[model samples]
Target: MKYLRKLVIGATCLVSMAASAQWQWTDKDGRKVYSDRAPPSDILDKNILKRPAGRVNPLVTNEASLNAASPVAAASSPHGSASAPKLSGVDKELAEKKKKAEEAEVAKRKAEEERVAKSKIENCARAKQAKTNFDSGIRIARTNEKGEREIMDDATRSAEAKRIQFIIDSDCK
Candidate 1:
C-alpha cells in the first residue's frame, strides 16, 4: 500500500513538471519562443504561439507539422519523397560511366607502355650487333647523302663504336 502511494505521488509530480513547459510569445524578430515557465503577466495572450501537450518545444517546428501545413514546401524539401525515388537509377548510371572511363584510360596506358618496351628492345638488339661488328675489325660502310658507299676510317669507326656502346647502355637497361 505504501509503495503504491509513493508511486502515485511520483507520477503526479512528473505529469505536473511536464505540463509546466509551454510556448510563449514571439520575439521581436517574429521567431516563436518556448519556455518551461509561463510568460510574464505583462505579455499579451495574442503573442502566445501554442500550448502543446507533453513537453514539446513549440519554437522547433517538426517535419510532420511543416508537411501538414504546406504540401508544396514539403515536396521541395531535401528529405522529401519527390527526389528519393529517382536517385537510385541516376546514381547507378553515373557510377557505370565513371568506371568505364577509368578502364579505358588504363588500357590505353598499358598499350603505350608495351609499344615503348618493344621499341627499346629493337634498339638494344641493333646496338649490340653494331658493337659486335666493331669489335671484329670489320670495315663498316655507310651511304652518304649523295648515295655513295663510303668506307668508314679508323677514327670514324672508333667514334661510331663509342656512340653505339652509349646507345646499348641506355637502351638495354
Candidate 2:
C-alpha cells in the first residue's frame, strides 16, 4: 500500500514537470506553432525553440544519494586492498637524476652571479680614481694655483681671468 502511494506521487510530480516543458516553431510560409515535442521535419531548420525537460533538483538528488553506491570512491580506495600505487623503477631513477641536475645548475648560476658582483665593484673603484684625477686638475687651476704661486699683480689677475673664462666656456656651452 505504501509503495503504491509513493509510485502515484512520483508519477504526478513527473507529469507536472513535463507539462511545463515548451517549444515553438515557425512554418515555411510564415506560420507559428508551439508544442512540447520537437518540431516536424519540414520546419526543423526554421525558427524552432526547445525548452529541455526539467531535471531532478540537485539538492534533493544529492541528499537522497549521499551514501549510495559510489564507483568513484570504490575505484580510488585501493580496490578493497591496502596496497599503494607505486612508481616504476625507471621513473624513480629518472626523478632522482633530474633533481641532482637541477641542483648543479643552480650552484653554477650562483657562482656566476658572485663573479659578476666582484667585477662590478672593481670597475667602480677604477672609475672613481679617474674622476678624482680630473677634478684635481680643475681645482689646481682655479683655487690652489692662486693661493700658492707668487706673481706680479697684473699677471695674477690675468691668470684668474683666464681660469674664470675657461670655466664659463666649459660649463655653459
Candidate 3:
C-alpha cells in the first residue's frame, strides 16, 4: 500500500509540472491557442488557462509528422498531379495593363490618321485653286493674241500689240 501511495504522488507531481510549464494565448479571432513559449505582450489580457486537446500517440500513426517534414516529397510522389494549377495575380494585372496600352495606341494612331487625311484634303483644294488660276491666265493671253491678229491697219495693230503686252506683263506675269 505504501509503494502504491508513493507512485500516485509521483504521478500527480509530474502532471502538475507539465500543466504549469505550458503558456496559453488567444488570437485576435478569439480562438484558444497554447504553446510551450509565452505569447507576445500585445495579447496579455486575452490569455487564459485551459486544458489542451487530446494528444495523439506517435507510435500508433506518425504519417502526419512524416508528411509535414517533407511536404514537397509527398506532393511529388504518387499522390501528386501531373501539373499544378495556374495562378492569376500579377500576371493578370500586367496583361490587362498591356491590353489597355495597346488600345490607347490604336486610338492615337486613328487620331493621327484623321489629321493626315484633313491635311491631304486641304492640299488638294489649294492645288485645284492653283490650276484654275493657271487656266484663266492662258485664256486671257490667247484672247489678247487673237485681238492683235484681227487688226488690219498697221498702226492699230501696233497699238493693240502694246496693249496686249501691257496686259500680259501686269496680269499674266
Candidate 4:
C-alpha cells in the first residue's frame, strides 16, 4: 500500500508539471513575448526563443535576472522595457511657468539689493558732507516744525556732527 501511494503521488506530480508548459517567442515588433499557448506554425520555427518547463515563463525569468544583474536598468524600467512617463501638455506648461517664476523672483531680489546699495551710498555721501560743514563752523539754520526759523547753538551743532559721524561710520562700511 505504501509503494502504491508513492507511485500515485509521483504520477500526479508529473501530470501537474506537464500541464504548465510555457512558450516564448519574439513578436513582429521585435519584442520578446510569452504565452501559455503555442505559437502559430508559420512563425513558431523562426520566432520561438524558449520553451521553459514548469509554470514560470522564460521571458519573466530572464527579465528578473537581468534586473538583478543591473540595478540601474531596474530603476529606469520598473515595468520591464516600457518607456518612461511622458509629460502631458498641461504638465509641460506648468513646468515652463514655474521656471519663469523662479527667474523673475531672482531678478526682483537682485534689483532690490541694488536699490538698497544705492540708498546706502547716497546716505554715506550726505553724512560726510554734513560732518564737513559742522567741522568748518558754518552756521546751519532750519525752519522748526512750528514754522519758526531756529539757529543751531554750538552744543546742538556738536551733537548733530556726532550723529552724522555715526551715520557715516555705519553706512560707509
Can you write out model 4's per-residue Cα lDDT over 1-173, one digit (the tens) per residue?
99999999999988767655667788878888777787777664556776657433333455666578677756555356557665454777788999999999999999999999999999999998888888887789989999999999988888888899899999999
Off by over 4 Å in 4: 1-90
lDDT of 4 at 56: 36
Colliding pairs, model 1: none
Instruction: Give the residue spans of candidate 1 off by over 4 A.
Output: 1-62, 70-83, 86-90
> In candidate 3, which residue pairs get closer than 3 Å at backbone N, Cα or C atoms, i.e. clash?
none
lDDT of 2 at 151: 35
Residue-by-residue lDDT tens digits, candidate 3, 53-137 = 4332233334555467587744543324356654545687789999999999999999999997777666656555544544454
**lDDT at position 99, candidate 1:** 97
What is the lDDT for 119 in model 3? 72
What is the per-residue lDDT of model 1 for residues 94-138, given as tens digits with 9 covering 90 to 100? 889999999999999999999999999999999999899999987
**Runs in model 2 lying further than 4 Å from the true structure:** 1-90, 138-173
Candidate 1 vs candidate 2: which has greater lDDT?
A: 1
Give TM-scores for every candidate, taking all chains together and pairing residue i with residue i.
0.54, 0.30, 0.33, 0.47
C-alpha root-mean-square deviation, candidate 2? 19.0
TM-score of 3: 0.33
